[model samples]
Target: MGYSPSVHKFAEGADVPVPLDLELVRAVLEPHDVGDPRLCFDPDGDLQFWIRAGDGSEAEIFAGDTGILVERPHSGGVFGIVAELVSRLGAVAVDPSEGRIVCSTEEYAHLPVSMRKDAVVIEMTGERLEAALLGRRPA
Candidate 1:
């Protein structure tokens, strides 16, 4: 719903603030067409949150203690929302498919072609890291 169809934040996991500030993300997103965010879970029940877009569909913004993963197919005039979030959150826009961290849409026309394919692995890796930090088992 933004410049890129899919964007992975916290490309560099070590750089995030410990006890990640959930409010910081809320603040950055509140001004947009999205509504309030609330705790959400998949059928598998991995912890995350969801924000409802104006269209009443869930926005792809996935918030975790360590990173945020967003993947969307439709464009709802939410352009540049991702850029602002990245800027305000100090989160890196990593396109592993491109083998680089993308800072702006101008850097390339294609942001990620393989992220959807690789997200499960990347997220699983993050789960281990998060589990270590929280002193808990990864679900």
Candidate 2:
């Protein structure tokens, strides 16, 4: 009964540009009353943060060159908060449940056709994540 979040990165290198403004992202998400915002970096060099939502739900967010990855609880308005964050940051939400993508930013329209058709499926492995981001069937 929860939702999974993922980001689409089109570039394949170490110098990918991060699309989100961390300051602004923090400002917008602050209203959600996030607690213990621990900032860190992923192995891929993505900026990441872990926070506890107002409702005590834990979430992890990773800001990367391609887009932002958000993992939040599905309850207690987490979905609404995610939508607002995506809109403010000019990102998109992939709805695996609906087998479609929810575009929240203008950039969504400019994304490549391959990305446009990408669906977000929840999986725990790196290969699955790679496949999902690449718009390819998971092997």
Query: lDDT for every model?
Result: 0.43, 0.53
RMSD of each: 13.5, 9.3
Model 2 deviation from the true structure expressed as Cα RMSD, one decimal place: 9.3
**In model 1, where do residues sit more than 4 Å from their true spots?**
1-19, 33-58, 73-76, 104-139
Per-residue error for 83 in candidate 1, Å, reads 0.7
Clashing pairs in 1: none
- The TM-score between candidate 2 and the true structure equals 0.53
Please provide, for model 1 over 1-139, each residue's C-alpha lDDT reduced to its tens digit, 9 standing for 90 to 100: 2422333344323333233456776676555434333444444433344444454444466665656666541333232455556556544455433434544333222234433332322222333322322234666
Specify the poorest-scoring 10-residue window by lDDT in model 2.
Answer: 8-17
